[model samples]
Target: MRDIPVVLSGYKLTVVEPPAPNTRDDGNGGQVVVTDRQGVTQFVVALFAKLRVGPGERAPKGEEIKVTLLTDPGLGFEEDSRVELVDPRINAYQIDSPDGRSISGISFKAMGLKPVRAPREEK
Candidate 1:
């Protein structure tokens, strides 16, 4: 699992549906934030995101949604963390955690926009 930096610098956090590519203007998917964790930032990807929901209804509606960058374990999530939902084009989603430490499962079929990574700096 590569470490990808998930940054939330100047992006808005919302649970709206992600904009369609041919619908309107190009929407900003999710942002990448790089923490102090080693080999953790490389797992960041705009195509996928993590959301934390409540445990009341099987399919909760009108519930609060938080979006956060996530890592890929190829099977499930690596940890139980809180995430925020940006962009209005995104529908609803769930996070799958198997090892509870490396990656989470996301239904990317409903997602439209993905975070675009900035160019790396040259030494």
Candidate 2:
């Protein structure tokens, strides 16, 4: 897997879904929370991102991305709130299934996320 660094400065990110525990099916009809290599629980946060563009430029495109976090995002990340990802990165993966089908795509991950604060009006 190749890890790629992501630059988010050109995009505006809005929370679509709050942070939730990432889980996987435990073999025996049970769900288990996923954790990172450091034993920190992983969380998934869905965000809607729109590219910032100047006037007359191509219409800013938008996409929804789910980011995996190695730690809890604490508080203040309510739905629809503007946020920024901390230490965001992407990984490319390819898995070949037994049926000769290939699955491949990029996955997003981050250390955490924080709510974006509005700038105060200067006096």
Candidate 3:
């Protein structure tokens, strides 16, 4: 993880798709604990999306930042909901292909992404 975690301030998740099994397709995916109750099929869902960034403290010009977010049980995110990622972790990963080639980039994962509460006015 990076020393200074990346934060997407004033972000709006336009599309939050359903979670899928971390099949290690990337060759560097993390572990996901899967537990069951009454065959309900519960597992930690890995969510990813391309979000529209709002102009805020971090982002002044406002640009789009695609985020690969992971959350437990998944989340029902409505379109254009103002949200923020809490304690996001970014790690660099390198993958070696079978043809003597490699690819490297940073992978992002947030502890949680929730709706941003309205700022309260000072008395």
RMSD of each: 19.1, 2.2, 7.5
Write the residue-wise lDDT of candidate 3 on 48-121 in tens digits.
33445455634334344444444452565444555566676677889999999999987665655666665698
TM-score of each: 0.18, 0.87, 0.49
Query: Which pairs of residues have clashing backbones in candidate 3?
Result: none
Per-candidate clashes come to 41, 0, 0
Report, for every candidate in turn, its global Cα lDDT versus the true structure. Answer: 0.32, 0.90, 0.51
User: Per-residue error at 83 for model 3, in Å?
Assistant: 2.2
* Order of the predicted models by lDDT, top scorer first: 2, 3, 1
What is the clash count of model 3?
A: 0
Selected candidate, larger TM-score, 1 vs 3 = 3
TM-score of 2: 0.87
Higher-scoring candidate on lDDT, 1 or 2: 2
Candidate 1 lDDT tens digits, 9-122: 333223343321212233576544443256443222222233334456243233333333333323222233222323332233445567665543422221122333444889
